[model samples]
Every structure is written in C-alpha cells, then in structure tokens.
Target: MKFFIKLCIVGLYSIPFAYLSVQTDYEADSKTNYIIMSLIIGVLSYFCGLIRADLPLIFGNIISFSVSYFCNSIAMLDKKRADFFTPINSVEQIVLITVMSIVIQVIFYKLARRFAKGYINIIESNNIEKEKRV
Candidate 1:
C-alpha cells in the first residue's frame, strides 16, 4: 500500500534525525534553547512530511526530537528530577533516551495527526477562498 511505502521512507529519513537527537553535543543548556531547537526540528520534519504526504512521519519526528530535548532540559534545569535522568555520557542513558523518544512518538501520533488535519484544513480553506475570488 502507499501508506506502507511512505512509512518506510519516513523511517529511512529518520535515521539521521534520531542519531542527531542523541548527541550530547547538540544538547541545549537552557530552556529557551531547548524550545528553539525543538521548533527547528519540527519545522524541518514537517516539510519532510509535507513532501511525503505523511502526517505520522511529521509527528514522529517532532515528538521524538521534542521529547529528547525536553528530557535533557529537565535534567539541566531541575535538581530533583535531574537525578532521575541518565547522564548523557553513559551508554545506558543514551539507550534510555532513544527508547523514551520512540515511545513518546508512538503514543502521541494520533493527537499530532489530528492537529495536522486541522492545520491542513485551514490551509485548504484559504486556498479555496483565493480561488473563488480569482
């Protein structure tokens, strides 16, 4: 099916994003930077999804990247929660981060898909209005 093919493509495309997401070097030191980086990842992934006509892919990328960023930000900002997070330099921590990121992506996909649909509807409506006036 077309959906399966698109899924495969998105999976392939996500390899680099996933790899980059785990790098401690990319970690944000402040909450502001974390938000900014997440947005950057989301925008880039959204375009990839648009190109593929795949909402799941968009959500997957956005959720995975944002969750990873969030976890890191929490570790950096909160003393209490900091102890719960695995240190970035450890292999166990890297695995945990990767697993959590994927789990969040799967769990939140439906909600993200709904939001994407609403966004698409707004864009379609705007285009329809423009066409009617032309």
Candidate 2:
C-alpha cells in the first residue's frame, strides 16, 4: 500500500513536468510523446526511491534522462526522424529537456521523502477501527 501511494504521488507530480516540457517545443513534440515521458519518469523515480542507492539524485536523473531520450526518440515517426536529427537547434532542444528533467526530479526527491514518511490518510490499514466505532 505504501509503495502504491508513493508511486501515485510521483505520477501526479509528473503531469506538470510533461506540460512544461511540451511548452519548450510546442511545434516539435506531440501530446502523446510527452504523456509517455511522464509515465517513464514516474516509474523510474519510484524504483530509485526503493533502491535507496548511494547518490540517488545523481544516478536517478542520469538513468531517467537516458531512458526518456530514447523513448522520445522512438516516439518520433519515421517521416520526422531525418528532419528531427539534422537540425541545428536539436542540441539546444535536448539541453533544455535535460535541464527540465533535472529540476523536476530534484524537487520530487526533496518532497517525496517527507511525504512517504508520514501517514498520507489515503490508505487505511484497519477498517476495524471505524467498524468498532459504528
């Protein structure tokens, strides 16, 4: 139950990140591509929290960005692939996305640990207490 709650929290946070990312390239990336990016980011963040590895902020962002780049790359259709890769501004675009990912993940890491430690009230472990009161 705790795991699910944490996952959901991260997932919820990702929606804004996706929106901001799309704003960076409103003409370039479609809505569906960013939706997939949000899902991937949430799942990666969840695993990073579970691993509790050393330097999680550094490691998690690196892994998350690498996966997202590939996913975003693949999400592009064949017709756009050639035009997308050769543009002079492509490097600039990637850099912006990288920075956005870092900012979002860093904020999540700061807040998620605090949220996960407390009782969220979204889940009730004992219905028995309410039943007895009734």
Candidate 3:
C-alpha cells in the first residue's frame, strides 16, 4: 500500500511535465525521453528510501534536474545554439519542486509507518486475547 501511494505521488509529479510536453509541440521522442527520466527518478527515490528512514525525494529531484539540464545543453550544442550550458530560468522551479517532493514523501512515509504500527498492534492484541482464552 505504501509503495502504491509512492507510485501515485511520482505519477502526480510527472503530470506537469507530461502536459507541457504535449502543449509545446514537443516531439514524441522527447516526450518518451521525459517519461523514461521520470521513471529513473522514481526508482532512485525507491532505493534511497531503502537506505534511509525517509525517501530523499528532494535530492533525487535535484539530481534528475541537473542531469536533464546537462542533456538539454548537449542537445542545444548539437543544434549549434550554444557552446555551454545556460543558466536555469527560474531558481524557484528547483526550490518549489524539491520542497513539494520532500513534503509529500515525508507525509507518505509518516502515514505508512503509522499504518504499519497499527497493524502490528492489532496482531499483538489478537495474540494476547488468544492467550487469555487458553
């Protein structure tokens, strides 16, 4: 259930990008690329959660954004647009996305932990009642 919730969160985060890709006359290939990138980010978040108490969603987003930026710059060069990477248009984009991802993941983690604890408590109570009957 926790994994399902996490997957939903990931899908929600990708929606804006998916919509933008469609609105901007983006090539089908580029749209597919973005989807693949998002999946990679989701997988990275999952692994990060395994090692840490909470998922480092913000860190994963930053890493994903940086890689995407680098790739975009390279693509621009291929088209003879620029020789180097351009500065990001909005620092706020990074801050907003990072904050949102972290907050959402933290909330989900807390809820999942609470649910798991409640499940264990119920099981323990049931065992205790059984023992009492015996």
Which run of 10 residues does model 2 get worst, by summed lDDT?
Answer: 11-20
Question: What is the clash tally of candidate 2?
Answer: 0
Q: Which scores higher on TM-score, 1 or 2?
A: 2
TM-score of 3: 0.44
Q: What clash pairs does model 1 have?
A: none
Native-structure RMSD, model 1: 9.5
Better of 1 and 3 by lDDT: 1
RMSD of 3: 8.3
For candidate 1, the 10 contiguous residues with the lowest summed lDDT are 28-37
Q: Write model 1 residue lDDT over 41-110, tens digit each, in one string.
A: 4554444444445565665555555554555554555554444434544235545545654455444444
Candidate 3: where is the Cα deviation over 4 Å? 1-91
